[model samples]
Target: MRSAPLLLLLALTPPLLRAPEGNQTRIGPAWSDSRNPIVTTFSGKRLDLWSLRPLTKAPPKRSIDAFLGTTNARTTDKRSLARRLSFDLTGLPPTQSDLASFTTAAAYGDKLLGRRSYGEHQARLWLDVVRYSDSNGFDWDEFRPLAWRFRDYVVRSFNADKPYDRFITEQLAGDELVAGKPKTAADQDALLATSYLRLGPWDNSAGLFGEANRVRNALMNDLVETTGTAFLGLTMACARCHDHKTEPLAQKDFYRFRAFFEGVTFRDDLSLALASDQEPLKGLLVTDGDKPPATTHVLAGGDLNQPKEEVSFGFPTVLDPNPVALCKPVREKSTGRRLTLARWIVAKENPLTARVLVNRIWQQHFGEGLVATPGDFGYAGARPKNQALLDFLARYFRDSGWSVKKLHRLIVSSRAYQSTQSPRRLSAEQLRDAVLQTSGQLTERHGGPPIWPPLPDEVLKANPAFLDDNKEKTKSWYPSPPERLGVRSLYLVQKRTVAIPLMATFDLPDNAVSCSRRTTSTVAPQALTLLNNPFLTDASLVFAKRVEKSPEADKVAVAFVLALQRVPRLDERRLCEDLLKKHGIPALCRALFNLNEFVYLD
Candidate 1:
């Protein structure tokens, strides 16, 4: 007689092989069968022609406006739209000429999306989703020098507009996808994307948690949480202790999902590192090599000592009722589990992957997702305010070859994106980068070891680990030497413990978990830091110098245009002129930089 497990597997296999139900596919609970939203496929595929028919019928803007209601139709002018597109796509304010030349919001958005800077901006947004940092976040905070390689890969991937499915696959199973040694740049890039696996804050050092297995388990949790939130957009880690309170996920589901990572190992292999000045450090990989892969067991109460029955590699059951049966690999390897999982995630039939990704892109553009909880899409999370609009955008994103820049153009051209009424505060990175650009100190040069901006003397004194043997000077932390000083804020050295104080004050998410959305708050420290931070003071001085050297006869007007992307109104001009008379160019410049118009996008 066949074993019980074999019988179960055989019984579960047929549903996965079944043809699409009517015109669309669905997974229950996560996605119900009755809700048939149009999905896209490639050329010659049955669904591809139908996908283009919608675009031929109506533009993305009209469709979006219709969904938002007639009262919300486009009214904002091109100038405001240009400014919005510039900041959203390139993370910088539009110049006077940039605003002047804009004929339509769509044209300017297209231009901005084509720039290399667009990818850099996209990379910064994705980094937050992946919990990326240059160093581990524990007390030690030892640097992950090679982490920059992965960061660079993300930027390049966006710039190239690599298909979203390929991006997900590479990040998950790039080690398995590449052949032999990774000798060429493309091969190396594939391996580099796997750095996503190693990115979450970890401390593998002995005695950090008193038990080696516990630390390993914690690392596994990080991997589970990152993968779930970043790709699947569900909080799978919530089920580690027990059944997920709101979702269909169970503790056994967590281990079964985790089994894909069992053979993965960390090595300091330079063969896969991107070419750079500094020596590349640890690499993430999977190799069972002669031995069978390790077994995974559900830890009762998430306690290691209380191990339960062993489990096999599988997808989450909510996505596929027979998770194990759904994982039939086309190209098998010794530890091909991850490759199978990666393929399943990008499969067109899976309801969550495209939806989650499109939501994140929406969140980055608009400051909040339609579903307010960007990372959590479970029953406990906030239901999407506009599910129809969300589904439409998700289908469009997939139909468009998962081109991020295309998504940006579609969203930015919408009446909602063009409107100035719903203003978003500049992110911590955007705020700093804007100051640098306004002061003419911003650097567009991308990709190198992370740079550290200047911190207060007291901060360096308090965090001696960042300082050289002579406590007076910083060792690995260097804010100057000119070239490094002007790099973008996203590229700033992210020592999780010693984050740039100004950024921390402005609410940089803690690097410990997958941050779905940044919290905006009104606080005294935020005000105090903006008022007194030396970086701002120095930028103010630079701003004054740049304005002083401008060819324009009206220096105050020049300063205002540089800072706020527009000439000051009569009242504003009078205030700046009075300050200029009393305190000089620096005072006028500082006041302009601090203006509400300068910090909040409208």
Candidate 2:
């Protein structure tokens, strides 16, 4: 009887059982660096550049000035800088007075960074990097109702400018960080941060060989990849089968890292029960036992069945160059391995943590990173274009107490950051937010479950599974009241299997892996969506209504201010006025919304 139930359970929950096929290690084509000097000597410090010593000179502005061409640089016009800063900092255009204010760029940046909206803007970028989703990705695409708690936690952390090191410690080992059961708000927030470990796409359906170990291995692989790429800037997953061909990571190092996570119990039931929604902030998405799996082995050729040798919990060998002595012995009650690993990652002696973080911050501000490959900083990654500038920023980031907001101020205050804005296509979220802003429909509501924005008819037609009439009809997977449609794009439900038409058309990431950057494309579908999508068309009418009360002479100017955040040039104003007279307010508003400058960053 027991064997029958076990067999039935195995049949019901299929696993993807197969040796890894595509997870091969390879040196990237661009990786030509022969000398790995930085891996050994890099301290992420700037003591040599400071003027504290007798022979040492002050930090030179040569790299920054040269990058900006500051000698020949034109004065940063306040209005132009304000517009750029507003978009970069808050994901919204500046107000008229914000453009005209006597405040310097640094002062304005400080103010913008203090706003609640700034954190939302920053969190959205981090969301892409973390593979955040409201639904489990595979075929079933079940809802992750409790995931919103984690999302809100991220927003709060960014707004508070939580120390990056502490942030890492909490996310990786929050349960260990907190004593006793979680009760207070601070305890709940710490517990929720560990949701970082559970963010990857998961499939419950049994696959090929159909076994529990296969399923568990797949989940473990995702956790390893996310941690490596997001924090250490190395593709540690590449070392699973063989030693990394280009980077210094070894196969033993991979297994040792994998050992840390063996004790975690990720409950699928957490999403299946209504009770799971109660006290979401107070509850945890994962549970860890004191006795982690007693053994982890070097799987020969990444084959679970062919274990070669058992490995103990430890840090990567290449980075440490020796075995890492744990901060404390494993307790009789618990393994306590995760907290130890977290400490190693954020330690002052770790060369990659500060460097990787500062590089990501640089990428967020500029269109590109000094190291173009933001996630991979190994020998397989691009060489930093300006090593001194990269080091300078990394050192300052650490020295300034790992405060993300302070780092933001330092970078934005530089001449390089205030340089002429390079026009790029608006991101999917930015486009959605822009539409809401122009129509005067943008809302400040924050936190809670994701909102379901109206989707296009084509998207509904493609995914008829969501269109059942008796099942509460809507074009999207989740139906919402009309008033709930205009929440921030950050709050929009992200069903990985069901892509939002507007977001898909504008290159929203697939959310299947860590996405350091998004591809920008100019295509006919984007134009068609802008011109014909009901979301855009309806928003245009609402926008027209908001500007309709203005006098005809001022209507064009008002529309320009509302849509583009600037007054229109005389010729542009004349063209818009002609359209308003010949056609109507709707047509003029639609035309303004469709402008290239309206959607692209200045």
Highest TM-score scorer: 1
Tens-digit per-residue lDDT, 1-602, candidate 1: 11124233223333443324673443421222212111111111112111111112235554666778734665576666666788888888887888778888888888887888888888888888888888776656777766788888999999888999999988888777776666567777777787887887777454555877776778777788788888877788778989776555667778888887777676554365445526653453433234666688998888878899998887664334343443433324546777788887777656577778888888877788888888887666777788777778877878889777788778877777776567888888889989999999997776877776677688878875665333433234666566568888878888777878888888898887778788987688877777778888888999999999999989988997788777778997888788888999998888777777778887
- Measured on C-alpha atoms, candidate 2 has an lDDT of 0.72
Q: Against the true structure, what is every candidate's RMSD?
A: 7.9, 11.8
**Per-residue lDDT for 1-602 in model 2, tens only?**
01123233223221221112463332111111112222333321111211111111226554455544564555456766786788788877777677667488889999899998898988888888889988776655666777877888889999999999988887887766665555566666777788888888776454644777887887777877888888878788788998776665678878889888877776433332223346332332664764446588999888889998898776664333233455542223445677778887776656567778888888877778888988887766887887666767776677788888988898888787776767767788888888898788888878888887766567767765454323323223766788988888899988888888888999998897988777788999999989988888999999988898766658878888888877889898778778888999899899887889888875
Q: List runs of model 2 lying over 4 Å from the truth.
A: 1-72, 100-102, 207-210, 267-284, 328-332, 461-476, 550-553
Q: Give the clashing pairs for model 1.
A: none
lDDT at 240, model 1: 90
Candidate with top lDDT is: 1
Candidate 1 stretches with Cα past 4 Å from truth are 1-62, 70-72, 207-210, 273-290, 321-334, 464-480
TM-score of each: 0.86, 0.84
Clashes of each: 0, 4
